[model samples]
Target: MNKRTDIISDHVISALGDGSEENFKKLLNNRSGITFHKSGKYSDNTLPLGAIEEELISQRVNGNRLPEGYTRFEKLCILSISEALKGIDIDITSEDTLLVLSTTKGNIDLIENPEMHHKLDLWYSANRIASYFRTKNTPKVISNACISGVSALLYAQWHLKEGNYNHAVVVGADIISKFVVSGFESFMSLSPDICKPFDMRRDGLTLGEAAATIVLSTERKGRVGIVKGATANDANHISGPSRTGEGLYQAIKHTLDDDRQIDFISAHGTATPYNDDMESKAFKRSGLESTTVNGFKAYVGHTLGAAGIVEVIYSVWSMYENMIIKTFGYDEFGVAEKINIADRNIKKELKNVLKTASGFGGCNAAILLKKNE
Candidate 1:
């Protein structure tokens, strides 16, 4: 028998907005958060990014009444979790509940600050966040690069299935800072304008800041259930995706669990030359090329650790509305592999949706979801 997990409540703090309802509305209206800003970090040059506005960030912390000593990333994490648990009946302090945090670089900017360097460990961040809820067990932190969010969710699924924890809250977050921006700049992997996923003329990806949370419980009270999930690492290359898409293919194939038909695919369309191509190859190999595929990176920019969790929440939104979100900047087919890309809003009965994410270090994770009917 397969263990079942339900996504009870979700919240997202992103460039688009705070709550999932607001963000989904904006997405349905074809709104984007990518913007241009003059930066002093990268040689005083103007860079187009998907950063959350300063005003929104300020309001989020102030409105939430977060602790005064918390850092920006900490405030974002706590705000997202608090919002997600708003009306849920789960007792956060119960020993039956678990907390999992997904982040690629926790306080990466602090590395440059001599005083902050002493507290940059990811475990420290996770412990601090969990302390707010007074959980019985120390929160688990997953730091598996860009796919960390999906990995964390998968871990929670297995943890709940193990008959140990009745409920698990998974949160992922990453913020754009000079430390992360300069590293991507060094690789010239950033797009100059809004990213165009699967577009023939696509240049590169744009980074965004976001924190998203999803609460999973073994009980079937939520509107969506996690059907299954899996992860695969081909180790094809240390910092590059497998050109053959083997890693991503295995991840998706396992998640499908013998179900050949998926209503839609929420892909990790980073808009880079190689990443998009690899995803197309994977989808085609998995016989999902005919499914309407959409990428959220164009709307929110590649939000690193938060990408998977935020996109999964958006996929649930699609299921809730029976609508397929248009690939924000996908204009024309550009990949060598032929795959159906959603360029316009699609109104259809969505039953099964697959969420996939791929990051540096050849890591790929995938999970399946079904609308709770």
Candidate 2:
């Protein structure tokens, strides 16, 4: 058997709140961080979004242990990574350890500060984060659109299975900026209100920003086990999912292997019309149509690069706690195909889980995790 990799620690900073405990509590109560703003940033027009309150963001950044010269994005990433590393014994400076950073846009917001925008270079941002930890190896960065987080996890999994690395610290982050907001606006995909992932009235996604970090170690034994994962692209379109859901279906199918059973699914549920429908079709083809599924987008909005990691961490928490959280904004049946979108939280002995994500470039990825027992 391949070496087993487990997530020993996780830290998520989103509109949902600071850490896993807080985020989990708010998720169960169906709290949403999305709010409407009639002024400042993005555009002068009224815009509803999922955003970390300015006060909270400032507090977290100001409290960051890292020194100054770090951008807000860097501060968020450092705070999350520091949170995950707290009380953990592994030396990040050891060569047996590696860092994998994931983000669709790192400091893209820095464009407003051209003197500092040079730091927006993803590789440079990664090195800064790594060097902050004094990690000895060149940090690996993944920028493969929205699936970047999951891809980083799988990369860590591969390294562990190769019997070379003892531990991997994976951090995914992205801050919403005028650039991203305007771009999504151009696509007409921003929700005017909190997004409803699989609801009949759902219109579009609410943009969100967050930095989430997890400590993955083959050295630790925990209930959260990284089993297997796969990625595939249907080459359907640059921005739209395949109507047949071929790529996503294949990714889920391969990840499930012969098991054909998972206690639940953490769906990509961007709430965009095509995304939700495509996922429904994919679930159907993968024979998981009846499986209970939920999306966290309504709670934290879609954190782009951080979405997959934060959702998976939430799933791990669900597995350990045996509590399935309700879909925050789901009210009515919405998808063209039949799939069980959890209308309410269900308490079940969740021994296994499946997580999925799809993004631009027609890419899709799936990951399966099981309780360590």
Candidate 3:
């Protein structure tokens, strides 16, 4: 398949199990892992979110050290990737393997506690995760807001394509903290209830936390392959996207141009009016109106940095099962340009699929995957 340079060997997705089984089952039910955080010291007026239960996190890892106790990002990364790599055979030498992590707020949870915050730093958090697997390669961490996860994937793909490494482990994760919640609250971008993406009644986003990981290699098996990937910046605004979605449109166009038949698209769908409108416009501009579009934000809320790889996991799983999951809270179309959203479970054989992500700083990324033949 186009003389594959890099292929995804396995993907592992982790979420709180308190939600619907269908939500946790696979990619088709559109179930979100969000729940009400009654223990936090936030205002009750805040919206519900897809927060992983503390009990679940505790069950996965055991320790009281700062890296183990305060670094939620590291813990989630270790748990998620460790599960994803279960039973997979790989030869990881320092020169042949690398570990790439993407996160917007790496171990910000340490900052929540004044005592821990004073002692923790960026390198400690980044290295803690890398040391978990005893990876000898210098761990690379990308903190490019929401686009970090996809950026990590793109970096791994480039390295593999260039024959720099034989294998790479990519992990994306973030945790809910008062800092992030308050940041979104200050921006007035948080939804008070369930997020309704591309719907007439859409309001804002519900921030969530999750960890998703993927193993990439230059070997192909019965799995998905990275066909194409592109990243671009709008250079328009820092916190806001371009009105016309120039970056997103370009990213999607370039990816689709490389492969004409894109069976499904995993949309960013943050449920914010601006992001949804921009994404819908980008899809229309790319002539992807007829392609099956799916959104995982509704199911997982906006996982910030983790959303990129989290959504990719959903897209890959959809391809594995030959089914398209509907957007969870979407009911009516509100955008001026009409684009197709997978509103119901549809079983269809898919070959080429596109996963797109956008974040602050006007950054946009699109990754294409083709089903194994």
Candidate 4:
């Protein structure tokens, strides 16, 4: 028999809130975490961002006292993982358990400080997180551009199905910093206002910071589980995505079975012209142009490495609530093909959902999730 892997428990700490359910509640209430910033902390230019307060981070984790030596990046991972573990009985130290860290730039904030170069290694951060939790296995680290989170989850699922481990703790995070902000600014991809996904007036993406963890176990079934997943790289450009949506189309085609219907799509709608256009073309080619779709970037901004996992967790919450949220900044449809962009919240049965992500280096991924019967 093939082992089944299911998402058991999860937690999210973003500008919106700390818990996964808490963030979902704020979304339902039409509260956005993205706010315009005047301070030159992250970037020299004033722009809107989904940033969490430093004081809040210091006071929210581990009874208001975080352990010593962990960077801000590490702190976010530990706090999120700790809270997620509260809902599950799986032992982190068990030999059958595995830990995985997903991030695009772990401790990249320390790049300017040459003396702190030791903390710049991604492996060091992953090892530190594993050591903090006393896990028996060396944690796996994935830094696959913006697809890190989804890649990590898919990787964990593969391991669980292969009987290499029974449980997998996957955490994806990236904190806002000068290095991160400047890079986007250079790309001219930082929006001055809240991001608008699939809107005619859409401009650029808003950057955000977050850490999200999802625990997957093969030992038992949960409310929802990943049914199929596939990744494809078009090798279109070093930093630009394929304009034809070739990679994403391939991923969606591979992930969906012939008879399965996708109720809605959690799109990688970054609000950029090329990305939104490419996604629309991909959905059209996959014969899903009319399927309802929504993007969470307007609420929490584009959360780098955490975007995939964060969006997936919110999708799960929507499935449980039996509702689909409107794209926050989306009003008029603007993509090349006609796709159903949710302009209003609709309550309905979301039995099967598709989550997709596209990133630089022409990477695209799709994951099909089903509500367990």
Residue lDDT tens for model 4, 4-83: 78889999999898889889998888788998988677877889999876776787765746678888999999999988
Candidate 3 similarity to native, TM-score: 0.91
Model 4 error, position 304 (Å)? 1.1
Instruction: Rank candidates by lDDT, best first.
Output: 4, 1, 2, 3
lDDT of 1 by residue, 150-249 (tens): 9999999899999889999999999888888888888888888889999998999988989999999997478889988888986798777788899999
Give the alpha-carbon lDDT of every model. Answer: 0.89, 0.88, 0.76, 0.89
TM-score of 4: 0.98
Model 2 scores what on Cα lDDT?
A: 0.88
The residue pairs that clash in candidate 2, if any, are: none
Candidate 4 whole-model C-alpha lDDT, 0 to 1 = 0.89
State the RMSD for candidate 1: 1.2
Positional deviation of 74 in candidate 2, in angstroms? 0.7
Candidate 4 lDDT trough over 10 residues, lowest sum = 58-67
Stretches of model 2 off by over 4 angstroms after superposition: 62-64
- If candidate 3 were superposed on the true structure by all CA atoms, what would the RMSD be? 2.9
- Clash statistics: count for each candidate: 0, 0, 3, 0
